[model samples]
Target chain A: MMQIVKPDFEFKKVYETLYPVIFRVAYRVTGDRALAEDLSHEAFIKYYERRNPLPDLKQTKYWLIRVVKNIALNYEKKKLREKKAYDKLQFKYPHFTQSGEAEFIKEETKSFVQKALNKLPYNLRIVLVLKEYAGLNYKEIGSILGIREGNVKIRVFRARERLGKIIDSDAI
Target chain B: MCPDNETLSAYFDNEIPSPWNKRIADHIAECASCQKRLRQFETIKNYLHEDREPSFESSLEQLEIRLAGLKPRTERVSLWKRRVAVPLPAAVIAAICIMILGISLIFSLTRSNLRTMSIRRGPSGTTEVQVAAPIEDLELLLKSLDTYYLKQEIIITLPEDSLFNITGEAMMFREAEFSRKRE
Candidate 1:
């Protein structure tokens, strides 16, 4: 028989222990602190709603990280669609500039490295973020992304190469 | 041939296996180009890590508050919704439609199966009632004969005997005059 568990002391402990790392992964992937916070909360809520806690904290962390990856992928897709629509509008209205608040948010939230990471393709960026920010090995990242370990290694290397070029060119 | 940058990167991450890892390590020790590539990977890794950790205190508080109000749904309810409610609404509706269709078909069939009833006055100054309904319906009709007597246009011209004929069954006659009783 499967037991349904509530969010108890064990859950709170896991949340505290993993929140920082989860937030870091979200932020690095999204490059926006507010959006990262939202995504992190969404991930944890999903975990809490699972009703059956993973056997241990390590498994819980992996589950939460996987959830965050899925949520962030959806967010990236929506953002891409919005950007395309905005670009079309911009083309029609040449004098229109980006909203000041949006500009401010981007400037405030995006770090130099984050900007470089964003320049990499989504696939490479995701693997690299998992590798560096989530402290996941290539095998772990591959497991989360549903790809092979070898594919993960190549993506991480390619991400680093592109990121290095972006940083050197930007001279930041 | 020299190991490509990908192999060096994998070597940097210690993902390469033993003999190849040893070979790459020896090659990097001797090769300046590979060493520079490895250093560049290191620099990039360092750059990625340099971003200061954002404060999560408020976010954690918000999550805690949200989690406080959330109750764990029972496995039964969750499974029910997931398996039966969410994906099978169409199936449920289809089943309901089929049942309704079946019930209506039965009702229509029963209505069609019921034979018509005829009551006529004979040339011998007697009345005859012919019924072709089922046994059950005949019982009910006999029970409700008083209401049907008032509703149906039944007339007997003579105060004589009346014959009752149940088709595909026995015939019964009442010597009492049905017209005399009505009068």
Candidate 2:
């Protein structure tokens, strides 16, 4: 007989084991802990809604990471559009002031490394995040991002180089 | 020629294959510039790793509570996979076929049993009647005719196998007669 529903205990165990990795990947990719939490919740909700559970925890982790990656990409695009619009508005009205809370959050939440990570191009930043935070190998990262392993390696290197430049300039 | 930083970085990550890996190692060991570049990659890796992952204990708790409230959707089984099951389309077609067969059967039986009655005057000036139908249908037809028509001496011809008896002014169908015929 086919299994209809996965038991709740089994699901809970998987959730506890994978939550940290999922949240870390989301945080590193988006550079916002709160957004990361939201993304993590979204990913788990998707997992719970699936009719059939993946065979094992490793596959489940990969599946959740892929969901978070796609969600974060959409968010990144939206953020970019908003930033472009904001920049346009700022150019139009030179006297408009940014919200004090926004400035405060930026100063308080962003570490030097995260600020540098944010400066790298989106493609390079994602590859580097998977490498350093998720601890995935090049082939795995390539599989997750739909790029070749060699491309993943080159992106990781380029991201590191750019990040180093940004950090060094900031330090100076 | 010295390998590029990308190659060195791949080498640092142990991503290069056998002979190239050894070759890059040999080059880095002898070359000061390559060594400095390798160190830069190491420094960058350290810097990325140094940023600690923030604790998400409360978030995890909240997520767990949310998940606890959710029930996983039951897997949908295809009709083909279900045992002793007919697909919805096939069952609908079968029902329509049965209904059509039943309706056509009823129509054909009704047509075969229909009777037309004809009344005419004979050369001798007396009325003559003719009807060809099943006995049960003839009895009903006669009962519905006007009493003026029934007053005349009428004749009804039934099938040889039909069992019918007419006795009184009112032509009534007896259930016992039909039941005996059926038996």
Candidate 3:
């Protein structure tokens, strides 16, 4: 018989508390508001589905946020998969100038640090987001990302340094 | 020497372990170059933290709708799937090892169907083990020792059907007897 483990905490309470934090993390990591919302919901749905293999409710907040990050990573892979299809679509529809001012304007409309953040590779950006937004220590970030604590520290610093450099260039 | 960028960054995060933390703190306090580096990091930290919050009320409403629709996905994991998930190579290797061990054990058992062991005295007056000999031969030797019992030499109290008496071990016991005779 397949056993299902149900935690003591109410699902609604967990949702209400964690939903916003996960959304923010997904947003910061993916740099797309819509994608962030979708990822957050998907993560919640997945965590809900895991009633058969329930995660510890005490660590649910962190688990939810990490799932958000992972969902963003999956989106990156999806983007890679669609790259060829996108190229073909671009070739077939030359009138579709996605490289035009509208896209650039949308980027410029984003916040300065967010624009700088969007420029960073997702791995570096997610580490920074988890540290700053989630208020996670290097060890916590490392545990979530399956990286060494020391590597987490280095990535966070390099991310900050790169972000600073980008902002400086944008200012110039 | 000034710590590398990574170490300084770790120091900035207070992620550096102590002794090093104390040392770096002292160094950053004293060193002009490190102070400038630290100030740059502080500026970046402030900029990252000082963000305007976007209105996520609409997103939250959409999330509520999604959450309302979401049902717990029933995952019926079968025992067959679990059994298959275990690596086949490891299982095959274990089976091979067990088979090899069984075969060797069978061969050793089949080899041990001998009657008795032929124990002969070496040139150094120690008994060496050889092939099987008759139990009657051992009984004859013991009976001779009974006839030649000058004092309490070789006090063997084995039963009539006790030729394979392993308690009277071959080499070490023979060496002890030889030493007693020399004394």
Candidates in order, TM-scores: namely: 0.67, 0.68, 0.62
Best by TM-score: 2
Model 3, position A82, has a per-residue lDDT of 78
Candidate 3: deviation at residue B8, Å?
Answer: 1.4
Q: Summing lDDT over every window of 10 consecutive residues in candidate 3 chain A, give the lowest-scoring window.
A: A1-10
Task: Find the candidate with the highest DockQ and give its number.
Answer: 2
| Candidate 3 lDDT over residue span B64-149, tens digit each | 68766765445557776533445889999989999987886676556532345543442343544453533334545555546754
Off by over 4 Å in 1: A1-4, B72-183
Better of 1 and 3 by lDDT: 1
lDDT of 1 by residue, A1-172 (tens): 3345555688789899999999989988888889999999999988777756688988998999999999999999998998898889889998777795887877766677777777887889999988888888888888999999989988988888888889999995
Name model 2 segments beyond 4 Å from true: A1-7, B77-183
Cand. 2: chain B TM-score? 0.42
Instruction: List RMSD in Å for every model shown.
Output: 13.3, 11.1, 15.2
Q: By DockQ, highest first, what's the ranking?
A: 2, 1, 3
Q: Rank the candidates by lDDT, best first.
A: 2, 1, 3
- Model 1 in CAPRI terms: which quality? acceptable
Q: List the residue pairs that clash in candidate 3.
A: none
At residue A77, what lDDT does model 1 achieve?
94
